[model samples]
Target chain A: MTFFEIMLLLFLIACAISIFFIKRLVNAVVVFMSYSAIMAVLWLSLESPDLAITEAAVGCGITTLLFILALKKVNALKEDGEADRDEHNI
Target chain B: MSIISEEGKKTLTSFSDWVSANSPDIPAEVVYPPKKDDHGHGHDDHGHDDHGDAHCDAHEEAHEEAHEELRSSAYEALHASDAPPAAPAAVTAQPKEKETVTEEGPMTERTFVRTLGAGYRLIAAVCGVLLAIILLVTVAFLPRFGSAENPALNEVSRRYLEEGLTDTGAVNTVAGMILDYRAFDTLGESIVLFTATVTVIFLLQQSRRKNDEARALEEEDLQQGVRSLPARVVIGIAFPFAMLYGIYVVLNGHLSPGGGFSGGTILGGTLILAHLAFGEQYTQRFATITRCTGILSVALLVYMGLKSYSVLTGANGMESMVPLGTPGSIFSAGLIFPLNICVGLVVACTMFTLYSLFTKWKA
Candidate 1:
């Protein structure tokens, strides 16, 4: 059980670092969702089921949806007009 | 706030004088044209006066409105009250705001690309190192994590852990602490969410209108973009199930790990599915920003009212009329049940509102 928890934490850190350096916004957001799910697992293993629930629902579910909706608004990763978007991007 | 003595004030003035002397010469102000009207409608008049083609005119108006809407109302209110005499000074006060947002751009190509050579990067690195050292020193002095004698393991927390269920009729100790003992903190969190939503809506209201204009054109066509056959079939199955699970979590919060916060997030996720699977226009039929705003405000107000009453009762040393029905039961926790409901409403509304605002509320 503890081994699984340690594995989850390591995966969580990996997800976080990967998301940071992914370059593509959509891919970063997908990685972020995985990170949130892994974090929820970590919280569960810590005997914090309430935080785990929130981390899964709000962090994994809602935040990822928020990111995807935003990507749609920006027409993200389409690459056709990505060059134009790149210049305007912060 | 520290009280400044006469000597301290004199020293401040001397310091100001020294700064003025040492700093580079102040640049002469390049004043903008005096705003013609009090309501910041001068831009509106200018937009209309162009007499351009309808589509282009509409586009320009939308663009102008979006930029103008980004500006603070407090600044505009001050402009309105000043009787137009202080217009020049006010414009100068917000130098960046007055800069023309036009096709060519505000700054020249040379200015945009200009760098401070190597020295600025070196200074930044040194400052970054110094800040890191200061922060590390502060962290080094903090009580170690999970230490038995740490301030975080105070008596209040221990008492809550021991007696929270018995006293509050909530099996979930976290729920008891947040929604009962320290409810004001949760109230503040809800208010923060409400404020953020309000700010986003206000800032993007004009863009939302622009999006609606585009939507108006697209609305005439049949719905084709988001809702494919397979996507529709899957979402139709998933959406209701998600909503069911969300409500279950909220209702059973006192007995379980989940509460309004997490359950609300689940509910919000359901609505996001409504947007993605059904398409913007389809979803907007039900989840309008106006409707969300109404629910959000009402929920927050109710939460405040409930908490205020609780606070007053506690202050007066009076027992609450609310019944603690039964521990480990559904209807057991009295006010916690209603408070959780209110929090759920606020959270769902906020998530929906944020999604709407970020996408320019196109639906």
Candidate 2:
């Protein structure tokens, strides 16, 4: 495979491995962010820069912001921190 | 504990022997993994170690004891109950794995076939519907070649720009035509916006009814929590500037790209932003004034159209009541300035109404 293809494959592998093995929800969110960034790069390489930019903006910017907001909101609603923290890490 | 029991070893040995005898062409290693432990019997073990003997003798003793207890319970239940089935052993041993596999395998295939056939039928039905829609749309629009054109209004401003502008002094042909030539249509459009705004306000007022009912019943259910301070602050800060820009766009539309409709929309957007920043209660506070503005703007537009045209609606060649002023000046476009103002007001009101409806409905 080409160098870029090999790198993409490696990223895909990392995402899958993290999804399978990672236990905390927040850590998984972080990995999901990486996955989205890699996907945007792949899209850019495919020469669809408009779609790539939109994907990065929406996937990594707005959606991530929304997720963080929701996380904080839910965290505020419930007093328990440790249980959900580990649950999120997964 | 032994990893593989003696009985398991015997079973394995028999299974290997059975494979070797039944299909000698198959490799021995392919049929079974190499035996790690040795069994005493060298030959005839395949037939000798029967299925029952393959199970541990200790498990057999435990099964025997459990079976005895089960028999006592069955006897007691039978004496106590009114009805009993004929084949008790048939019911008891029904879960035998070999028997289960043989009976269930065909039944499962039957179910799979039935479901797959149903799925295919559903797919065919959906495809047929989509294909019909495609055919209908394609056939209907085929005659026009997909170009649906609206009828053009009479072209009056072509000569007005070349000849009349020198005397009328209106530089912007569109503004000259709208205000001087067809001020009535602009006024009508403004009125339409105003009416739309009123309708929206009326709709939003229903939220008060809801709030009243809530207070009557369960006020506790109301979400009285404060919104994010950052969101409120940002929206509040941005609101005034957006409204001012919208006004600028509407007022300077004749000079640039925007018009009354565009400006009104911007103004409406600003109001909506304000509503979003503040709570529904703030909207209710200003509801009356919004409603009045909406109604008055429409009334003013209607009055102007009627007074200027003095003819039936939708008729062409209405007389321009006001004289066109100097070219490139704000006043030069006769009725255009007033028409734009009307348009701006209508757009603003309509948007405000729509936003109000949304906020009210949400509340």
Candidate 3:
């Protein structure tokens, strides 16, 4: 593998591992988003531009937006949870 | 196996501790009550070995009122039984200790769940390791990567590379292969997208009549939408060009690397961005629920009709009438161009509908 490909693969593994350890759900989603972005780039390097574009749009864009919206719905957003905690303390 | 189980136990405990710490709904007193001097001490050591003494002390002070509430209930139960008031303290000590013991050992329903979860983790890890070993052995036996002698570079691929352009009348062999040669497969994919959209709509569609609180929340969202001037400005500038690019990619599928799926996703993303920037009212005017359903149904039907005609004609050994026009042109591919358009429309509508359903409707 090329150096660039190796670096991307290593970063992908790091992102996967860090996602399990990340305390905040939002941060985990963000890490997963970066992983998708790297995967898209990897697809391009592998000479499948069709998969690259689909991965960029579907994996990075639509999936991340859906995850954030789900987080908002469940009041799992950090700001929302912090506000709820303050109200409970009162 | 024992080492893996020990690791699993550690992970399970840490995960549970993290959940109890982060979830605001569960009260600290409910999770970690004040430990008494006798049985509580041993169980606390067993369960909360990693939890510092300072953490326990802080929870003990913070939940002092909860302690008083529990103590009063215990005292009443003891009084009714004609036991000494000091007996209430002993009875109170047993509950937390019992709870901790139940959590650590397989004793109750909660213990059953814990055991099942741990068993699941063990099985999954074992399966993963076996699959990895199998895959590695298989790979080791295969020909080297990129070797010309590899079975992947067989006559089937050679035929596609040599005659795909002439047979399908498309410069892009991938498009020729998918849309022309394997048109039925593409039809199946389009139908799958349509089915998924219908399932999501069926599951998440809200009732026609909204409650007052939901209406108020929607109004607030609209107000917030209008106030975001910078987002509106940015999306307004980016929207048309992105839509144009998506259209370009779809139209040039027979001549380029991208085809229906990528282009459709880009189109769907732009639609989502427009909805975000212009508010639901503006987007809903053009992309209503009924309109999206109509588009999806029409696209899938058209794809099915065209592919069925081609398949029937080819099977009968008759000279199919659809003219394969000159290669390297947009309209050259006999059936590929229209098929791509149909797939693109189905995918785009499905994506946009999924986004709208998720954000606007109550599940």
Candidate 3's C-alpha runs over 4 A off are: A79-90, B1-142, B206-213, B222-229
RMSD of each: 17.1, 23.3, 12.3
Q: Which candidate gets the maximum DockQ versus the true structure?
A: 1
Score candidate 3 by DockQ.
Answer: 0.28
TM-score versus the correct structure, for each prediction: 0.67, 0.41, 0.70
Worst 10 residues of 3 chain B by lDDT: B77-86
In candidate 2, position A83 carries an lDDT of 40
| Residue-level lDDT for B357 in candidate 1 | 68
Q: Which docking band does candidate 3 fall into?
A: acceptable
Model 3, B1-363: lDDT tens per residue? 865554433333322233233333444335343234423443343332333323333333333324433433422331222222223233344456653543344335445666787788789889978998999999899998778999999999999999998889988898899998888788788888999999988877643233333334354454234445688999999999999999988889999988898888888888888877787877887887679889999989998898888889899997678888889867888888888888888888998898877776532
Q: Candidate 3 residues A32-58, lDDT tens each?
A: 999999999999998888788889988
What's the residue-level lDDT of A22 in candidate 3?
Answer: 75
Residue-level lDDT of model 2, residues B1-363, one tens digit each, is: 353464354344334433333334434344444333212221122232232422222222223323422323322232111112222222234356633553455456657767887788789789978998999988786545223342222244346657656533455455555554566676666656656756766766665464342232212211221255788788778877877887776676555445665566666656655655675556556543567475556647554764455344225665556665665666655555666666667656665665445433423
Native contacts kept (model 1)? 0.70
Candidate ranking (lDDT, best to worst): 3, 1, 2
Q: Mind giving the per-residue lDDT tens digits that candidate 1 earns over B181-272?
A: 98999999999999999898887886545433334433432233343568878887999899999999888888898889999989988887
> Worst ten-residue run, lDDT, model 1 chain B?
B26-35
The superposed Cα distance between candidate 2 and the true structure at residue B208, in angstroms, equals 4.1
